[model samples]
Every structure is written in C-alpha cells, then in structure tokens.
Target: MTDPETLAAATVVVPALVAALVWVLPRTWVTRTALVGALATGGLAAALTAVALTGDRPLAGPWLVIDVPGGLLVGIIGAVGLVSVLVSPAYLGAAAGALVDPRRRERTYYSALLVFWSALLAVPLAGTLGAAWLLVEATTAASALLVGFSGRATALEAGWKYLVLTSLGLGVALLGIVLLAAGTPEGGLGALSWQVLPTYAGGARSALVVYVLLLAGLAAKIGWAPVHNWLPDAHSEAPAPVSALLSAALLPAVLLVAWRCEQGLEPVIGVGPARDVLLVFGLLSVAVSVPFMLRPMAWKRLLAYSSLEHMGVVAIGLGFATPLALAGVAVHLVAHAVAKTLGFCLVTPLLAHAPEAARSPVSGIARSSPVLGGAMGLSLGSLAGLPPSPLFVSELLIVAGGFQAGRVVTATAAAVLLALAFSCLVRALLELTLGEAPARTGPVSGSASASGSVSGSVSGSASGSALPGLRGVGVLVAASLVLLLALAGAASWLPASDLVDTLMKGIA
Candidate 1:
C-alpha cells in the first residue's frame, strides 16, 4: 500500500518545502526555480485527485484527509497554480526586466507565488478545522508581499490595509473556533477535528453563536460588503497574474472554509439560520459592488468588483443548500476561475500597450489586438452569465434551487441583481472592444513600425512579452473554452439528485 495518509500530508508539505527552496535559489535561476516548484505542486495535486477517485476510501490521518471535496479543490488549486507559473515567466519576466534589481526581485516574486500556492493547497486538505484556519492565514501572509511587489507608495498602503483587515477577520474567526471548541462535549476540550464536529453539534446555542462569529469574520476574507474595502486596492495593485490567482483561487478557498463551517453548524442550529445569514451577506455584497462596477475605474479594479459580485452569487447558491444550488455553486466556482484568469491575462498585454486601458478611458482594443480583444469579450460575456457560458448554467441552477427551497423572494432579488450586473458588464465590454482606437500624435507614418519594433523587443526578451506561447493569453483562452464546454456538458447530463446526495454525505 502506498500509504494514503503519508501521501496526503506530502501533497501539501512538499509544496511548502519546494517554495522554501525557490526562496533561497540564486537570483539568476528564479525562473527555473519557480517552474520546478509549480510542477511539483501540480504533480501532487494530480496524485491527490487520483487517490480520491480510485482509492478504496477517503484517506484519513491525524494531519489530513483526502475526501472527495478536498480532492476536487486540491486539484483545482494545483492546476491553477501550474497555469500561474507558466504565465509567470512571461508576466513576471516583464516586471523583472523593468525592475532596478531584476534578479533579486524575480526571486522574491517567484518565492512568494510558490508560498501562496502551497498555502492555498493546504487549506482544503487539512483534517482539522484549526489547521484549515492556519492555512488561510498563511495565504494572506504570503500573498501580501506579492500585492505590494511594486513597492510603490500606493502598493504599500494597499498591502498594509489588506494585512490589517484580513488579520482582524482571522482573529474573529479564531475566536469563533475557540468558542466552538469550548462548546464541544466534555467542556469543549478535545482533538478539535472537523470529523468530530457532527458528534458534538447538539448544543444549539453555542453552535449558533460560533457559526455566526465564524461566518461574519470569514465573510471579510471572502470580500463580502462593508468589509470588502481591501479587495479593489489589493487586486488592482498586485500583478495581473497574482490578481488572477487571488480572485480565481484565494476567494474560493475561503468560501469553501465557510461552506464547511456552515455544514458543521447546520445540524445544530438548523439550515435556516445559516441560510439566512448567507442570504443577507450575499445581498449586501451584490448591492455594494454593483455601483462600483458601473463607475469608471482601473480595469483590474473593475474585475475585482466583478469578483465580489460572483462571490455573492456563490453565497446565494450555498445558502439555498439544495442539491441543484450546490451543484451550481460548484460549477460556477470553476467557471469564474477560468473566466477571470483569462480576462486578467488578456488585460496584461493591453495595459502594456496603452497604460490608460486600465482606466477604461482608452478604447478599440479590437483593432489593436483582435485576439486579446475577443478573449476579453468572451470572458466578460461568460462572467455576465450569458448563454453558452458555464456561469449561465450555474446561475440558473442557483435560481432553481432557491425556488425549490421556498425562498422565492430571495431568488427574485438575486436574479434581478444578476441581470443588472450583466447589463453593466456588457456595456463596459462594448466600450472597451468597439470604440475607436485613441488617436496617436506626432509622426503618424512611422508609428506602426516604431510600435511594432517596441512590441517585438519587449516580447522577445521577457517571458511575458511572448504571450502566445505556453501559459500565455492564448493558452488561458483555450482553457476557458474547454472548461465552459465541460461545464455545459456536465450540467446537461449530471443528475441533480446525485449532486445532492454527494453534498449531503460529504457535509454530514
């Protein structure tokens, strides 16, 4: 026997060890170091998934558990991390080339990215809720450096804000964890494992208090309203690749934690109370992010708000707790990850050519780089839940689930908010894709050749400059398309009942 328990722990710890190695590697070898680290993480993720699917049963150990849900999430984080590393050569290559100390900065960036990936992978595999909490905190710490990698005054400020807000949120979550521990049988003193939660979940009052505390605290981390101040700043300031990972991977990881916590408490306080809280938060996040999306701002910031909106949608699906809704939530998480990553990748090249593209003032990207323009259009369209996109299927499932759950009013409100969000996003996309290219001044005849020369020079030297290669915008777009097809096919064939059964069993 290949010792599933040992494999499960290794799946996570090995990545962390690799990240540490990347941190110490010579500056000149930063690219190779990052690639090696990412490859190791991806391989482990693949192993974990295979074990979950083909192994006899869930792998259980004192430190970790490779259950179906955890396996699925681990695979996602790993796959995405791999793509991130592929893109990093190009993206971070461009950044490093522009830096005062390129070698040192490249090492720092790659190290931080690897560390972030390792932390993200660890959370889902944790056997205990306490360990999960620690992993989430680790993600914040590792990503914070990446957020402020530019070392600009604004980047620094944004990083500090992110640190303070997330730390506070984690603190509150810790308090909730402590309370839950205290309420466990035998005066709450025990191993504090997630597996034991159901056994001691009978104390309604304590469970309710702990659930509320945990949800409220973690809600901040998920970028829910009122506490979502750090999102725009952090996402906007971070490199595009980092931003993609943050939005597409990090937020979902925290949401998974919240989902697990809800499952733990549902048996005690009933699903109604937990659903109610999710509904409230979902509505608030939608309402708060909508107006921001409508306003003119940086391209990355706009995407960040879009992330908030999507998180709200995920919350709604989770609150419904119906099999259809949960399935939708699952599919939507995948859809959002692919769409957002592609969108971020597309914008990277655009921003390089026209710095104002980030501000939404420059237009006509379709004429400048038709491929990227189309990719951006498709990504936004998908994110808006338009037909043919996986988001559409997920949102519909969520709505259906809400109706089934007798939350007609809630469903109606979510639908309306989604429609409004869709409209706003569509309008922005049109302006960016269809408008005339801003006029260039001075020596129009030589501009084309000059621009081409510059573009070629930039692309030839740095990894990011040659984006058509592996892990480039082209690859991201292809991946998005494939995922969308898979989602649509799965939705059409997968039974809702089966999803419900799996969710119930997994959570129970």
Candidate 2:
C-alpha cells in the first residue's frame, strides 16, 4: 500500500486492536496499555500530517483516505487524544485511590476509553457522509459510557442526557442524509459519497430542507446552544480526561463532518442559506455561553460553557469562509483542544486534594500549589483569549476574516460578545485561583497510589520510585505548559502550517 493508505489503515486498525487487547488484559496492563495505544495512534496521525504537509495526500476514495483537510483533523484528534489519555492515569488512580476495589472498575473504564478512542479515530477516515454519521454515533455510544464511568447519579444522568439528545439530533441528521441521497442520480448512495455528494446535494428542491435538518442535527452534537443542554452537564460530570476528549476532540470531529456537509451543499443551495444557518447557530451559542460563564459554577461546568463558546467561534469562522477566517478556525481548533485539555486535567489534580471543587471552584492555588496555580492560571488565561494564548490570535483572524467577508455587523456583535466573555472568564479565573484558599484537605484512600500522591498514600512509592509532591499533579501542570507552548508555536511557526492554511482555505 501507498504511505497515505498505510497510515490511514493503521489509524483505525491499531486503535481497534488496542481496545480489544486492553479490554481482556489483566488489570495491571489496562491503563499502561491504553496509554501506549493512545501514543501509537497519535504517532501515526503525526506521520500522516507530515505526509500531508508534503502535498502528497491520497485522493478521497470509497473508504479510508488521506488529504490535507482530513489529515489536519486526524492529527489534532490523535494529539489531543494522547494528551487526554496521558492524564487519565492520574485521574483514574485518584478515583481508584478512593475505591476499595478499583481493579474491576479500572478494567471497565479503560476498555470503554479504548472504544471511544477507536471511534474518534474512525471519523476522519470515513469516506462518506453516511459512514461519518455512523462513526459519530459510535462515538456517542462509547463516550456516553465513559462519561458516566464513575456510575454516580450525576454521571449517569449526564450520560443518559448526552445519549438521548445527541441521538435525536443524529436521527434528524440521518434523515437529511437520506434526503441528500435522494437528491442524487436516481437516489443512489454512490452520488452521496464524499467526493460526489456535495456537487449533487444543493440543486434539488429539498436542498434547503436538507441543509436546515443537517445543521439542526449537527448543532446538538456540536454543543451549540438552543440544543446544547447536554454539554455542560456531561462535561462537568464525566471524569476529567473523558471531559477533555469530549470537548477537545469529539466536538471538533463532529463539526468537521458538519463543515464538510455545509461546504458540500454551498454550491447548489447557495452559500447564503448554509452560511446563514451557521451564523445564527454561532451567534446564539456565543450569546448563551456568556451568561452561564459569568455565573459562579464548578470549574468543569465553567469550562463546559467555554467549550460552547469556542465551538461558536469555530462555527462563525467556518461560516465566513474567508482565508483568514478558515485559518483562524484551524488555529482555534488546535489551541482550544490543547488549552481545554490542560484546563480539565488540572481539575483532576485539584479534585484529588479538594473534592468539594466538584460543586464550587477552589480558591488560592496560586499561593499553595504554585505550580498548579501557575498552570491553571495559564490555562484560564489562554481560554480567556489572552496574549501568549494562540486563541487570542485565532479569534482576531476570525473577526477580521468576517469583516473581510463583508460581515461587519455580525463580526462586530461576535467581537463584542467575545470581549464580554473574556472579561467575565478572567474574573471567574481569579475567583478560582486567587481568592481565599481552601483549607489544605486530607486525602481519600483504599487502592494504591504513587508516592506523595494526593490521597492517603505516602510520599515515597513502595517500589522506591519518586513522586512529585503532596498532590503529585505537578507533572500534569508542567505538561500543560509544554503543550501550551507547543500550541503557540504550531500556530505561529510549524513546518506544516502552510498545509493547515491550505486545508483551512478549502473549508472556507
């Protein structure tokens, strides 16, 4: 097979095998094996991205294929997935440390995680809208289970809500897909394949209906407000690592599909109809997230609303369809993935020391856990669109791109709303990290923990391995910084950046 074919094949195959292997492995191997699988999957994506950079991607075909656009999504998904998985152990171990018998639960957790990971890996490889829809649905199934992995009442409710809402949305989207198929030659599915589908879709009488249904359905999954009820609940209730995947990876992947559909139909239905739908969804989403963000809530809940806002920004960027706006979409997608991953992962460590943080924000990380404080602060800052946060740069491009597209009024409104969000988010972060410090809390314990792990575990490992500190979360903090820097660099000066620009312009 050619290089793209090989990379594309491995993209799905390796994750499938790893998921199966990890499921049946003895307890000791579940976490470690899953981590390895995550890394391997990410490595393959990175290699594929490098190939895409060289402008030698495979043609979009009947099944798995590679091109600049697909390559970018694949690369971001894998990289973000790896980050989430690396931090999973810490979150899992913390949860385990609180359990009397964590082995069984750990097995179930990691197995579900691999399944979710596999589904996430399949999305960009899909060759047809039908196939992409199936992959997106598969993700909901696998991830709903992981969202409620703890099986707590809230987690269970979050999982149920996520499944029902997203499934209903997907059901609508499927109808649109069928209609899209009918719009083809003699209504055959062949014309509905990715390559030909778009050209055939927008000319039919049902084009507007198809576009609206598809947008509504995708909006629910993408966490756009008016249909975003599931987002905050699930993101807040799920384990931190899973939250990262849902927000950073899954949301964007689903959006990628919707983006393809939008661009596909733009030719026949007219760009105005499709673009307007995205703009409405985008505006409402940004507007809705701000009020929720301003309210004092749990850290993850706050971040969850932020996810909604960022998704809105992406929608706006895609709708504008200008070179700069599209580039902003690409930049923001990666920056948001990395920054949000860092933000959610920090919660795991925070919760380790202070479980009450689940319901309310913890104050004074800056004074006590300076490393944690600095990292959390950095994450919040980045998310708030501060300088040094590539999100800031991306947002600028998006607004400017909108203006350049002759969308001055809409761009102005979005900019005003985003500025409000930024200010409110900064205040929220200060409340989380700079206010009164929570009393140094005691740790819970029943299972094993690393040395100096936050729980009842001792400072030194039984095997004499070194540990970070009372929290043992410093590693996560440090990793967040590194990722933040990497994200900034990639936005400003990566070798593949021109490739990203080309891909972005295609979407535009």
Candidate 3:
C-alpha cells in the first residue's frame, strides 16, 4: 500500500480527474466511468482512514492532515459518495427537467457529483483553516447545481437559496479568519494553520469577537438554527443521492471545521466562552427541530429537520468537551451518517411507489413492499434513538459527559430535549410503518417529486427503473444495521480508548 499521505492526496485527486473525464465522456459512458472513479476514490480514502486510526499521532502531509477525527470523516465521505454514485444512474434514468441541455445531462450530473465528492473529500484532510474554507466553498457551488438539477422552478429556487445563504455565512466566517490572521504574531497564512492557531497571542476581546464570528458563520452551513433557513428547502429539493451527501457528508465535514476552530482558540479565549457558544447553538438547534418533527411534514422535509436536530446533538457533545462526550460524538457521527443516508436513499423508492409521501406523512410502507418498508423502518427507528441503536448509546454518553464536565443543568436540559425529540420521532415511526395507507386516487394530485416539484410522477417503480436502486438500498440497510450495532458495542470501551485521550488532549 502507498504511504498515508499519498493515499490522502489520491483520495482527493482521483475523483477530480474523474469529474473532468466525465465532462468529456460520451453520455453512454458517464455512469460506468463515474462508478469506476468512485470505487478508486473510496478505496484510497478507506485506506487512509485505516492508516490514521492505527497510528498514534496525526499523519501529516504538506497540505493535509489525517488525524483520527479527520480520518473518520474521510471514511464517511467516501462511503456516502460511493453510494450516491451507485444510485445516480437510477435517479437520472427516472428524472426529467434536468438543468442542463438534454444532450449533456448525464455528463453534467456526473461531473458535478464527482467534483462535489472531491471537495468534500478534501475538507476533512485540509491542513489549514484557509484551505478548508476554500474547499467548503467549492462544495457549495457544485452541490447547489446538483440541488437544482431538476430545473423546475421550485428546485431552482431552493438551489439558489442554498447557495446564497451558505455563501453569506461563509463570508462571515472569512471575516473572522481574516481577523484571527491579522492578530497572529507571524501574521501569515501559516499562522492560521491548525498547528499554529493554538498558540494565538490575540487578547481576550479580539479572540471573543473572532470566536463568535466563526461559530455564527459555521452555524448556517452546519444547518444550526437561526441561520438554517436554507436547509429544509435545499434538502427537500435536491435529488435523493444529493440529499444524502448534503445531510450525511457536507454538514458534518463543516462541523469538523468548527470543532477545529474551537480547539485552536480555546487556549486563547478560555474554555468557558467557547463552550458556551457551542452549547447555545446545540440546544437551540435541538429545540427548533422538535416541534417540526412532531408535525406531519413531508418525508424529505422531516429528514431535513432531523439533520438539524442530529447536528445539534453532535455540537453539544463537542461543547461538553469531555472524554465521554467526545466518544459519544464519534459514535453519533457514524451512526447518524449511516441512518440518514439510508433514509434519504429510500426516498427514490418511496416517492416512486407512493408519490403522495412528498407532501404528507408516509403510511403503511411495510404493507406495500416488505424490503422497502423494512429498510424505512430501520432507518426511522435508528434515527429515533431506539435501543440497540448506536444513537441511543451515544446520547447517553453525551449526557454523562455533560455531568462529568460539571454542567448538570445544561446536561439535564439537553436530556429533556432529546427525550421529547425521541418521542416525536417514535410517533413518526409508528405512523410511517403502521398508519393506514393513503388512498391513491388516480395519479397523485399535488405529489411532490424528489426535486421538490409537483409535476413529476412515478416515472419508475420497484419493478421498473428504480428496482436496481432499491436493491442497492436494501443492501445498504442490511450493512448499516450490522455496522451500527458494532458501533454500539464498541461504545463500551471507546471513552477510555487512546483515540479519545488524543482528542481530549486537543488536536491543535
């Protein structure tokens, strides 16, 4: 095997080269070629992850660093990206109104997807704050196109909303980065690198200003409340594969950037203020998502709100900044990624079989197709924090960590919020699996498409173009169940593991 650094670079480069190749490839060859590239990208990323996890220290390159947290993220992005590519052929086959010219539609979609995948792959491994920020911004452009790929008025509007909102938030973050750089002793791009930021000499007032600006800006991109107005619309409007990447890969990758910021600045600004900022964001996000979850919203829309809630959980775990919480955050990240991806991937089959699910709650999914229903059930159940699911264990660890950190009230409040959210999701699960099926009167009148429009119908079915994709989803669901259970089992010793100790020591 190649060295870790070489693997890391290849992970980002292979997809990019594929993106370029797909742009010029014949329409007939786009999906096949893209899949090959995706396999290579995933292989390299997974190899790098193994190298990082086994090493005692961060594996550093000139432009990249594969630390434990970064390694986990790379692995998640690789897995999610590969699955997205796997499902893209099915999506494109059934979809219409694509934003690009008909002759170039396949090439356009695959190119944008591979480009977006490459950028997400790079963000976790970025060696400096500036590079990470640039890579994240690159994702915005590529994914916004994917989000609006349907070319419908609603899809286009949602895409534009996502682009504008995230860009604005990133702008604010850029200002904060500039401020930090100006105050650093060496006063260069290198000063803003993760390794150097911990030694920030900036005074308390300046540091506080920088911290607020950074967190507030990152909050929008992470879909944290108050700045998450674009999240629901974008997630609901994008293609199923694209939605999975947004919720599972993009959100957490950006959150990692925020985590790095906190670690870098804590020594300069004091832990109290930094921790408080994160806690506020986390609690507010959870509070905001609960009421929405209780409402009988659309399927993709509900998952969108759930993303807000789950990201909040991870944020709170980060804020607690204890060994147990870090461990919980780790487990939660992997569990949430798997569960959320499965949920979104199911949208293709769900929408194809029952178009009405786009506007109202799903019902009796199990009665329609056993495989589809079972997968949907597992996805929702896992998200709801049911026992035997890793999320349940992770949440417990987070609460315990909060107490260990001496924030009893905060921990208590978070636990209460989580319980309330859990009940809401459980109710949703029952309604999803057991509620009476909606009467399909002819073609659905106002059935929303995966693209967030009401015009598209079930152009394909489980026995049609979507059949292979549904089979793929079934395989993913089975794999996820075993993986999540393994994570739950691993939680027993994760808190005391060397990785947790390394994280607790502060990566910066």
Candidate 4:
C-alpha cells in the first residue's frame, strides 16, 4: 500500500479525475461514476486523517500541508461529499422529473457535482494561498452549473448572479494576494505560499491590508451579509444534496482560508483590531438573516438563511480568538455541518410533499411523516441553539469568550441577534411541521402532485412505522448529541488555566 503522505495528493485529485470520467462515461453510467468518485475521495480522506493523527508527521509537501487543522477539514469535506453523493440519486431523480430533458443533462449535473466536491477538498488542503483561492474560483464555476441544472429561468438567473458576485469578490481577493506578494523578500508567487508569509511579519501595513482584503473577499463566498444576496437564490434553486454540500462543506472551506490569513496577520496587527472586524461582520450577518428567516419562504431558502445565521455565529466565536472560543468555533462547524445537512435532507421530502404556493404553505407534516417531521424539527432546533444541542454549548462559549475579551457591547448584541434568529426559526418550523393541510386546488396542487409524489408516499407509509432511511435521521440527531456531550467532557477535563496557558504560549 502507498504511504498516506503520498496519498494526500490523490485525495484531492481523485474527485476531479472522477469528474472527467463522468463527462466521458455514458449517461446510464452517471450514477456509478459519481459513486466511484465519492468512494475514492472518501477513502483517501480517511487514510489522510488516520496518518495525520497517528503518524510521526504526515504529508508536508511544498504545495500541501496535511496538519491537524487541514486534515480535520479535509476529512469533513470528504465525509460530507460522500453523504451528498449518497443522497444525490433521490434528489436528482426528483430534479430529472422536473427538468425538460433529464437524460441529456444528467451527465452535466453529475460532472459539475463531482467537480464541486473536488474543489471543496482542494480549498482546505492547498498549501499556498493563491492555490486555495484558485480552487475556490473553480468551485464557484462548478456550483454555478449545478445551480442552473434545472434550466428554469430562475435557476439561470441565480447562477448568473452568483457567478458575477463571486467573481468580483475573488478579484478583490486576488488584488490582496498581489499586494502581499509584492511585499515579500523574494516577491511574486514565492510569497503566495502560507509557509512563506509568516516569515515577513515585519511588514505591518502590507500584512494588515492583506488580512482585511482576504477576509472581506472571502466573506462573500462564506455568505456573510451585505454581500450575501446570491446565497438564498443559489441554494433554493440547486438540488437538495448540492445545497447541503454548499452550506455544510463549502462555507467552512472559505472560512479555513480566512482563519489561515488571521493566523498569519495576528503577529503584526495584534488581535484587537482583527477580532473587532470579525465581530462587527458577524453581528451584521446575524442581524440581516433574522428578518429573512421570519418571512415565509421555501423550506430550502429558509435553511439557507439559517446557514447565514450559523456562519455568523462561527465568525463571532473566531473573533474572540480565545482558546475556548476557538474550540467552540471548531465544535460549531462540525455540529452545524451535520445539522444543516440533516435539515436539507429533511427539506427534500417536505418540498416534494408541499410544493410551492403563491404564499409558502406547509401542512400534514407531523400527521403524514412523523419521522421526517421530527428530524426536521430536531435539526432546526439544533441550529437555533436550543438546549442539549452542540450549538447551545458552542454559542455559550463564544459569548463567554467575548465577555472575557472585554467586548461587552459586541457580546450583548450578538446574544440579541441569536435570540431573534432562534425565535424566527422556531416559528418557521412550527408552521411547516405542525399545521393542517392546505386546500388542494389550482396550479399549486398540480405542481404538488408532480413534486410531492415520493414524499407523500414515503410520509404516508412511514407514519406510525419505521424505514431504513430513518436511520440516517437518527445518525444526525445522535451526532449532534454526542458533540454536546464531548464539549461538556472537554470543559471538565481541560482546565481553563491550562487552555489559556497553551494558547498564550502558541501566540508568544
């Protein structure tokens, strides 16, 4: 067997290779092509994680850094990619039924999906900042195709908007990279490497500008507010599993880029200003997403807004820069990924059953499909930071860290935004999961007849009964619970004094 270090490159490359295979393979083989790609990537990610955790010093190539953080994120991207692929058949089955020519476009859809997965893996593991940025651009292109796979006017519009906005954002990021590179002793592409930037800590102005530009540019991709106009549209139009991968995996990949830049700049700007900027943006994103969540919309769009809220929470925790807060950020990322993916999965059946009315309407959820309804409820509750969910622990840690950092106003505002967002989510879920069935008439009913067939049957059959797929819901719920338990355990096992000491030592 090949050593894990050697396999790291393969882990990143395999999905892209599979994407090429999807394009070349016959239409009948698209599903198999996606499965092969997902499995290969997943296996490589697992191997990389095992080696990084157990080996003396895993891969450390000139263009790749398989450290603990990189390994953790790469493993997560791979795991989420596998789940997305598993759910793709059902999702695309529904989509194909809705599309004009399912057979002709199916190959394109699968190819783009595979490419998106590959780009996601590359974003976190790329050793050079420029390479990571380029990978993010690739993901944007791939996702644009998937977003528009339906060939509807709305889907095409959303795709174009996403492409334009993200391209502009990346252009800004590239300029930042250019500025940072120019400041380097060797200059040009040599300075673009993550390993090289820290060596030039003396150039304070250049480092600060680079940090600001990178964060702002990446914030658009991360779905931060003010620049987040494209998120809801793209997410609502894309296939459910694609939406899940976008929310659960892609957002965090961009964040890893932001965090890397933060680490490089902390020595120069100090933590104060850098943290303040994040806190401000975090607060704004939460504030903006809350009102949208309050308004009625499609289930998937609602989930997209929820993603904005959770990403805000992450930014807030990261802004604190305390060891406890950083740990909370990590925990929140994992919990949110699992919970959001589960939510997207549940929404799939809901959309199929309810369809879109002139006004958003949901009915017969609990009565017709108790398992899915319950799963949706639990996932939304977890996202809203309700008790016993890992998000609750993570949010509390973030708020505490904010106070400890002496940013009292920011902490207070964040708490308020969180409360508002939670309330809005609860209200939306209640409407969807507990209401009576709407009147079945008009075009809405026709669309529902077409879209809701599978969900209605599944829900009707599964009520007062169990199905194998329900096991997936159980896994999601259990994962969130375990995360909360782990947070509690870590709190007790690792003393605050030790944590502070360790963090400070790393900083110094």
Give me the runs in candidate 2 sitting further than 4 Å from their true place.
96-103, 201-205, 441-476, 486-497, 504-508
| Residue 452, candidate 4: C-alpha displacement in angstroms | 7.6
Top candidate on lDDT is 3
Report the C-alpha lDDT of model 3 over 383-411, residue by residue, as the tens digit.
88999899999999999999999999999
Between candidates 2 and 3, the one scoring higher on TM-score is 3
In candidate 1 the C-alpha lDDT for residue 78 amounts to 77
Residue 429 CA displacement from its true place in model 3, Å:
0.5
Per-residue alpha-carbon lDDT of model 1 for 1-508, expressed as tens digits?
Answer: 3566666667777767767777787766768877876787789788887777565456655567677667767777877788777777666534422222554777777878888988898888777778889999999998988888867666788789998999999999999988887667744323457666765544777788888889888987889887899998898877778888899889988888888888767778887887898888888898888888887666778889999999999999988878788888878887888888877776556555554554445566565656656777788888888888889998899888899889999999998898888888877778767868664221111111101222222223222333332235676787688888888778754435454456656634
Q: Rank the candidates by TM-score, best first.
A: 3, 2, 1, 4
Question: What is the lDDT for 141 in model 1?
Answer: 92
- Evaluated at residue 231, the lDDT of candidate 2 is 99
Query: Candidate 3 regions off by >4 Å?
Result: 440-468
Error of 2 at 166 (Å): 0.7
**Runs off by more than 4 Å, candidate 1:** 1-3, 53-57, 96-103, 186-191, 200-202, 440-471, 497-500
Best by TM-score, which number? 3
Q: Write the per-residue lDDT of candidate 2 for residues 1-508, one digit (tens) a residue.
A: 7667787788777877888898788877888898888889889878877776576434677665466667777877887778777777767656633211345777677777777887887787787788889989999988888877776677779989999999999999999998888777735555667666556634655787898898899889999989999999999888888898899989998998888888777777887887988989898999999988888887888999999999999999988878778778877988888789878877755555455677776677665556566777888899999887888888888898899899999999989999998998999879867888765633334332211223353232221112222244455556666766776666654323566456644432
Candidate 4 ranges beyond 4 A from true positions = 53-60, 97-101, 357-364, 439-508
| Residue 105 CA displacement from its true place in model 1, Å | 0.9
RMSD of each: 4.3, 4.0, 2.7, 3.9
Instruction: Estimate candidate 1's alpha-carbon lDDT, on a 0 to 1 scale.
Output: 0.75
TM-score of each: 0.90, 0.90, 0.95, 0.88
